[model samples]
Target: MEKVELLEAVQKEEENIIRWRRHFHRYPEVGFEVENTANYIAEHLEEWGLEVAKNVGRTGVVGFLKGGEGKTIALRADMDALPITETKETDYQSENIGKMHACAHDGHMAILLGVAKVMAFHRKFLKGSIKFIFQPAEEGPSPGGAAPMIDESVLEGVDYIFGAHLHSLYPVGTAGINLTNMMASTDNFSIEMIGKGGHAGLPHESIDAIALVFRMYQEIQLMVSRNNDPLEPLVISVGTVNGGVATNVIADKAVLTGTVRTQSKNIREKIIQQLEDKANFISESEGGRCNVQIERGLPPLVNHESSSLMVKNAATKVLGKEKVFILEKPNMGAEDFAYYLEEVPGAFYWIGAGNKEKGMDYVMHHPQFDFDEKALINGTKIFIQTLMDVWN
Candidate 1:
């Protein structure tokens, strides 16, 4: 399948692709409450001649296309939107108020749906099965859509799973991927300090909670600098800190909240336990009580070498070799798609959606974030090429 042939085929259905994307953009849903979104996706999948299964993982829809199976491959598109109020003015701007598809999930769903329609029409040409997975809660309420879908045995016969995310950093017509370690795991930690409050004028009358905060900040940096491996990428950032009410008063309580990111699971665990140890040591020694809280988030996404190579070859075939390139390093950003790669050998790719000329190059999660719809066609073509090449 040459790039021109694939592009032409996908372009024929460009109107429906844009329509789907705009519809999702206008009416966005967040978390597992994507009922209308799930139904809309299911209706399309069912009408496309694929066996549709709804509520696979609580508001998630799965379309099973059994095309004279050899090996089963799952294509996933996230269905959740972010909890951001739309700031960009457009015809398809979010009407759902306070919810927007700022992460380009609207485009992801549109691409996969477009691929499904094309694959359904050419079912006889396929040698294997394709599972169209429309998942919910990618932005999360913890344990994201991928985990629950896996728990429901969504990948029971799946041999290789593939997922793609729209990246605003890359320009239109280019796709980027990493051979391994596509993204890092995210873990959250919070420290609460309690001490006796007193007037600032009285020097040694009270144990200061604010003092413990700085001491613990130094200890956290030391943990990252001295305890963790330098070769491995690790980041400990305190996003928020709260203490003290007045300038003349010594605060009795303080709270520090932040996130920890790492690609290696072992290193992530080590750093997490070390944070608790460090916070406890500093607070107790300062005659103050401290409580530590930890929340584990998505696992690191590491792509399989063979699957990655296949995607690279398929991408090269669809887009020129010059348009396809390997990423230099893994991203510290987290993705729930990491869950699917854990159970099945798979690869995740970046579908470039940035277009500064059209003013669609805002970074993801920003209220003004948007993407070039032209990239949706490339995403569909790449997916089509990847599947079709499997049988070639």
Candidate 2:
């Protein structure tokens, strides 16, 4: 089938697409609690006559649509929501308090489902197999859902995998298909400082742990500027700090938790080592003690050439050559989809959902974050095009 005809088939399912997205959005679930989401997806996959597997990675669901059984291609959609509360006033706003699909995983699921509908209808034309992966916990409660899914053999015998994210960084009609790197590697660290406490009036009698933590925070940036290569992308941010109780009393204990992001694993390791070393040095100098813990997160997402080329061509064919964009640089944001790329040759694309006039320009993970619903058609078509164009 031609690209336009396939997109037409997807467009016919627009109502159901929006229905699925809103249903998931209203009843948002977080992390491994995607039981409802998985069951919902599994029911649809089974209805389409696809072989369904539930709880592959706890709550993850994979649907296999075997055509001629030549090669298998995986299409992944994350099924988790963030911890933020919904601020939008729409009727479809989250019914679950303190949980929302702020990152647009709802849209991701809808797009994949739309693709599944189209693919199942056209299964006669498809020469290979298609696996629809509805993953849990893409928004990490650390280590993420992709690694566990892979551990359960999700990527076994998959020749090529394709994934897409709906981002509010560009206008709704455009899309980003990077030639190489898309997102950076992300890892987290926490530091706890222990010291002697005393009254504010006392100077030498008290060891200020908060002061040591502040100094360590300042020194971490030097690891990026002075130690790593200037061209190498790296970011260190302290997201949380807790310690002192009162202004009159010096803090005896303090804690700092943050994240480290880099494009290179070597740089990631070097920066982590410097963080621990600096924390120890600063604490000891202040007559205190420090403990640093580093937890590894997702690896950097780099698109393989063949799969990337397939997406680039399909996106260009669907949207036109002018609307197709190659990202100027990779983002510091991380994705668990990187784990799938580690196992198979795959590419993850970005479908633009930003429209300033529609008040849909909020970025992902923001409390007011949302996208133009029209973008769903484009995302759905892109997935369809990529799959059909894979063999061509």
Candidate 3:
């Protein structure tokens, strides 16, 4: 289909797309418990006469639309929500208390469904096969959904894969495209400091674990700033701290939990080692001992050059050259989609969903985050164009 006709077709289904998004938004599920969400998606795909596979990676769903004997392309969307209560007062606000689609997965699903709808109707014109992947637990449980799906051979025989994240960082009508390292690697660490407990009034009688951890936090920040090269991006942040139970007593133990984000593997390894060493040194110097635990997470998301070129050309064709934004820097946020790119040549891009004038500019994971619904159509059109550009 031509760009104008394809856009008009998506516009015709705009209301249904919003309806599906709101339905999923109201009943958000987290992690691997997205059974109902997966069933809903599978039902739609099956209804469209596509071959469906349920529970490929525990709760993920995959739909195959085979048009001819050619290369297969996969389009992916995450199907899990965050563990946050809905604070928005909108009518479609989450009915599942304490779980919300704060990261715009609902929009992602809607856009993919819109693509499925368009492609299913125009299957006769398609020259190849398309796989629609509804992945679960992207918000995370260790290595995340992508890894498990890959283990199940989700990328088997796939030629190219494509995915997009909806973001508020850019205003609506712009798409962020990058050639490499679109997101950072995420790794988490925890430190436990142990010391002698005593009355708060008698400081000399007790080794202060709280003070040791506090000092270690400051030292870790300094280590990141002074040890790494200025050109390399690295960040270490302590997100949680826990210690004493009583105000009048010196705590015998304290724990610090945080995450490390870096674009360089060597720097990531160096920072992890430095963090453990620094924590141990600081605690031992202060008459305490420290234990460290690091849980390595998803690798940095790097966009393949050929796949990125396809995305850029597709976006430019669908939305014009002015609407496509070539991002100069990658985001510190990490995505499990990195695992998919590890095996298959693919690119992950971003769709602009923020509209400041509409009061829809809240960042991801925020309680009040939302987007202009029109971006769903924009994303669907871009996805369709990318598929056509690739398969033709």
Candidate 4:
């Protein structure tokens, strides 16, 4: 079908897509424990005449639609929400307590479902296979759902893959895509400081673990500033510091947890090595001991130029050339979609979901975050058009 007809088909499903979004939004699940969410997705995919597999990555679902013999292409949608209670006063406000679809995952699943239904309807005329991946735990517990799904050989025969996010940064009708280095790698570290405790009145009797943590924090910021190149993008953020029980008694131990963001692997490794070295060096020199642990995360999201161009072309066709934009810089936020790009040629683009006129421009992960529902139709159209571009 032509792009216009494809867009019209998606428009016809806008109501259904919004209905699916509201259903997922009402009962949000978090992390790898998305049982109801996974079941719901699998049921619909199976109903659509697709070969559905549930619990691939513990809580992930995959739907396989075989078209004519050709390379297999995959489209992914994350199926997890945040651990926040909804404060939005909408009718579809989260029915589950302490869990909300603050991020656009709800909308993402809806858009991908719209694409799946439309593409499956044209299955007989398709030139390639379509794999619909419903991933869980994107908001995450280390490694995330993408890695687990990849470990289960989810990308086994996939030739090209595509994923999209409903972004609040752009207006309601524009799309932003990147050709290279779309997002940074997110890594975390923890530091433990041990010292001797004493009464607060006795100045010379105890070694201060909190003091040592302060020094280590300074060194971390300094390392990022002085040890690394200025042009390279790197962020070492100290997120949590826990220590001391009483104000009168000196603390014996302190723990600090922080995150690292970097666009280059070499830079990421270099920063981590320096962090461990400086932390231990400073702690031991001050009559205290420090232990640093590292948790590696997703790699940088880099889009293939050809695949990204396909996305841009599709966005232009669907939303008009004036509405499609090339992002000037990469995002500091991390996404597990990076994992998929690492395995196959693919592109991850942002769809404009913000609508300032309707006050629907809240930043993602906020309690009142939501997007213009019209963006759903535009997103599905882009996904379908991109598929047509790739398959043809």
Once fitted onto the true fold, the runs of candidate 2 whose alpha carbons sit more than 4 angstroms away are: 1-5, 195-208, 242-252, 284-288
lDDT score, candidate 2: 0.88
lDDT by residue (1-392, candidate 1, tens digit) is: 55455557688999999999999999999999999999999999989889999998998999988977577889999999999999999999999999999999999999999999988876666789999999999999997888999999999999989999999889989899999988999999889888889999984999899899888988888888988888899999999999999999999999899999999989988888888888888888978889899998988889998888888888888779999999879999999999999899989999888999888889999999999888988899888888876656
**lDDT for each residue of candidate 4 in 1-392, tens digit (9 for 90 to 100):** 36566666777898999999999999999999999999999889888899998998899999999987777889999999999988989999999999999999999999989988988786654788899999999989978999999999999999999999998767888999988889999999999989898899995899889988888889888888888898888888999999999999888889889999988889988888988898888788878888889998888888998999999998998889999999878899999999999889999999998888888989999998988988988888888888788878
Q: On a 0 to 100 scale, what is the lDDT of residue 383 in model 1?
A: 88
Q: Which residue window of length 10 is worst by lDDT in model 1?
A: 1-10
Which tens-of-lDDT digit does each residue in 37-104 have in candidate 3?
99999999999989999999999999998978877999999999999998989989999999999999
Candidate 2 per-residue lDDT over residues 1-392, each given as its tens digit: 27556767887999999999999999999999999999999999999888999999899999998878566789999999999988978979999999999999999999999988888888775778899999999987888899889999998879999999988988888888777888999988999999989899995899998887888777877776787788989998899989999999999999999999988777888888888888888888877999999998888898997888889888887788888898878998899899898889999988888999989999888889989988888888887777777765
Off by over 4 Å in 3: 1-8, 196-207, 244-251, 283-288
Candidates' RMSD to native: 1.9, 2.3, 2.4, 1.9
Pick the TM-score winner: 1
Could you tell me how far off, in angstroms, the CA of residue 287 lies in candidate 3 after the best superposition?
6.1
Go through the candidates in order and give each one's C-alpha lDDT: 0.90, 0.88, 0.90, 0.89
Q: Quick one: RMSD of model 1?
A: 1.9
